[model samples]
Target: MDMDGGWCSLEEIGPLSKLRRLTLHGLEDVSASSLAETARISSKEHLEYLELHWSSSGCMELRDEIEKQQQQEVVEEVLEKLCPPPRIHELHIKGYFGRTLPNWMMVVEACACKSLSILCLAYLPCCTKLADGLCRLPSLERLVIADAPAIKSIGSEFQASSSSSTVDGGVTESTSAAFPNLKYLSLVGLCEWEDWEWEEQTVDVTAGAMAMHALERLEIMKGKLSCLPPGLANNKRHALRELNLVELSNLTSVENFPSIVELIVCDCPKLKRISGLSRLHKIGIGRCPSVEVLQGVPSLHSIELEDGTIERLPGYLPCVNPKFLKLTCSKELHGSIISGSSSEWEKISHITKVVIYDIEDSDEG
Candidate 1:
């Protein structure tokens, strides 16, 4: 039942205790947070999936600071009242313009969905920080944050803070790691992000507080991320298997993910170095010409390189251990590789399979 865009209208849904899934659209049109509590969302224990969406009008840019703050307060209050059950599996929030998320999603001890497994936050243009308690979720496996442009930094708030307790003895207590069950993660179109400050503290990592310990695949693309956060690099679990870096405008290097089996790098113009992965096997690279150092992977088997501007093979080719090479290049570069005078063939003689494509040949085929 829908009634004229008011939270009081949701009261009819309150007693529908068996509701398994709910999608509330036009959340921005609602007022009267006090009425939201009467909907009794907390009582819907069978509810597993929830979507809260606001209108797209306010997400592009704020009209003014005062109006933004007022809207944030009202939305937060409404969300606080509409908290999901503790064991809800999936929560998706889209088109949220609020600067901060509601307390039900932030505060660790009181987080709304402790059993959340798949969480997606998209088009959150005004949020500066991610939910602080995201790290505390033990069951979350897939998490994605997309198209948030205002965020400048990802601070230690993304990590689970350690709590200290002293018993009769001087022994200290320990907290669990962040993103313990996270396997697949993606961060896309965060255009304004600049810093990732995960400062190692007295209780961080040494007491087995490594975050994303179970993460297997990570994708970071289309951001100002110059470097990976320490939280990722310092993970002792070495469980990450696939690393994808694409279109990152300022990223300069890719290294130190020891367990990675396949690495993909494309359109990252400023990236210069890739090294120090002992288990790497396959690599795909496209339009990333500044990469001058590619070394330290003895187990590599295949290399797919695409560059249309080069007149000669890249200097790093002689250092790679891949037995199969597939290359795309300019016609002049292809001519140089075929010419007996060029060292290109001599450089790749050890490869068991080699395929080449020039721009003209590619266009015809």
Candidate 2:
């Protein structure tokens, strides 16, 4: 039912105990009682997916600071009462303007939604950072955080606190294991995010705690992430296979993907070096002018470059033996590559297939 002005109350949905999925929109007018009654319904246990969104119109034209603050408080209260029942496998919260999330989204033990696997949080413009408990969920496999402009860091709060029972050989009892079961993660459009702090106690993979042990693919876009999470980058046994970094301005180097098979770097102007990717098979670089070398990547078979400045090939090119090579360069660079006198010609001559395009052609075509 649409949550527009007084159309349906939570009391009406109380008997739908078997609900498997639900989307509630136009939450601006929903009262705190309506939301509380909705959460109290028995159907919460059967809900597998839930999406909550507030109306854009309700928050768009407000110019009064006091009135806006009052509205924010009401929104927060309504959201607090709208908590989804435990065991939900998927949840999406969008356009929430509250400075903090409700307890249901962050309290791990109390909510006990151990079956929760996929969580997507978007357009949360006021939340400074993710809820600490979100990273400690036992079954969370996919997490997406997007468009949170105030978030500046992801720190120890993202990890499970150390437990009291001491284990053998100097390991902590609880061992702050964060995202232990996560396989896919994406951080997008967090314009203010700058730091992803590494909690050494939780991230030290060699200490026998498997942190982010199940991650396979990671995508970061439109953020200030200068480097990867140290726990993820340093873990040699991590299962990551695909890594994509797009529009990260401060990132200078790409390193330590020991088993990654696919790598994509785009629009990172400060990027310079890529090393220690031993199992990579495909590589794509675009709009990164400072990147100069790619080494220790012997398994690379496909390479694509767009608007890059490197004139020579990798020092280990004889071992790379790429099956496909594509380059889109400036007119001068394109001329130099095709010229028999340029060293770039000899380096890529052995490739079985090569595709070339000038910068203008690439853009126009």
Candidate 3:
């Protein structure tokens, strides 16, 4: 229902016992206290999903005003009330801007959301407590945290205590454990980070150990990741199939991905080498001026290079066994393609097919 600038109480919506989905948008007058109450009192036995979007400018002001202990008490009361004996399966919150993650989040994590499989939070401000609380959800299968500007580290206070388990000889325990069932994770637009190093420690040993073993896909875009988390480099599962790294300007190398089938690197101008991908099937490279090699990838089937200028192909190019190759370049660099001998040409010809589309002709036509 359209409830913009209207006064409504949680009791008004609580009797939706069979409601499977609920959406609240453009709520200008609903206080955080009331919203929290609505979530707490609403019958969640059949509620599988809840979406709340507060886009009014005044909501921003409300966030600033609600930080008092008394206001927080109202939120706590609502959360305590909404703690379902059995949690819903999915929860999505957008445009949430409180300084700290609400306490009900912890309630959802600890008990109310035992069956939760997916949780996504977008456009949140930086808060470690929120991150910590999210890690407490035990049944999470897919976790996505996007456009959170203030978060610099992944481990928050809610990290589970370390456990003793070994996978492929890699240390597989952390003090904090969240997302135990997660199979896919995507983190995008985390801009406040200049680097991912939170300690003088050699690598994030703890964070790496907590990754869900079933994880198969990872995508990190436009974050301040100067280097990838060490856990990704050391994880043993060959289940990882796809990786996309976009606009991470500080990334200089890719030293992981043993079973990865597809790799896409775009807008990373400073990248110099791709040395770690040993089983890549498809490679797409774009806007990288300094890349010098596409080596160590044995199963590569397709390659696309766009707006990139490299002096020479990697020494391993002569050994590549790909089925499809597409390279687009400007007129000034067209001569480079003609001059480079087909040291790898025999291998290219042996492949199933090859199609080279020249962009210059398209521009001229």
Query: For this target, which candidate reaches the highest lDDT against the unseen true structure?
Result: 1
Put down candidate 2 lDDT per residue, 1-365, tens digits, no spaces.
Answer: 45334446566666677888877776777655455556453247888888888764466468887877777777888787776677689989889888788776666673466788999999987787688777667788999988888888888567554233667796646555567788999999988788887644443345336567678998999878788765667545558899999999889888877879999999998888888898999999888877767888878889997873555544444445789988887777788877768777787788898888888777788
By TM-score, who's the top model here? Answer: 1
Across 1-365, the per-residue lDDT of candidate 3 in tens digits comes to 24345645555666657777666664333555556556443455787776665442443345465444444344334334444435478777666554566655653435647787887877765343345555556677888878788776554233343234666769664444445667788888876655542221234444334445456788888866767655556546466788899988787887666878888899887788886677888988877777776778777888876662444344444566787777666644444454445443443455566554345674577
Alpha carbon lDDT at 224, candidate 2: 80
lDDT over C-alpha atoms for residue 138 of model 2? 79
Q: Estimate each model's TM-score.
A: 0.89, 0.87, 0.76
Clashing residue pairs in candidate 2, if any?
Answer: 17-43, 163-174
RMSD of each: 3.3, 3.4, 5.8
| Segments in model 3 whose C-alpha atoms lie over 4 Å from true places | 1-9, 32-35, 38-43, 59-85, 106-110, 126-130, 156-178, 195-210, 308-319, 334-353, 359-365
Indicate the residue-level lDDT of 211 in model 3: 45
Give the clash total for candidate 2: 2
Instruction: Measure candidate 3: CA RMSD.
Output: 5.8
Report residue 217 deviation for candidate 3 (angstroms).
0.7
Clashing pairs in 1: none
Give the residue spans of candidate 1 off by over 4 A.
1-9, 59-65, 110-112, 161-164, 167-173, 199-208, 338-341, 359-365
Off by over 4 Å in 2: 1-7, 31-43, 161-164, 167-171, 200-208, 308-321, 350-352
Q: Tens digit of lDDT per residue, candidate 1, span 1-365?
A: 23335443577778878877887777776676887777788889998988878775773467787877787777768777878887689989888777787777787563557788999999887788888778777789999999888888888768654244676678765456677789999998888888988754433356245667788899987888887765576536478889999888888888776788999999989999998878899999998999999998998999999989866677888888688999998998888886757788787877888898887788799
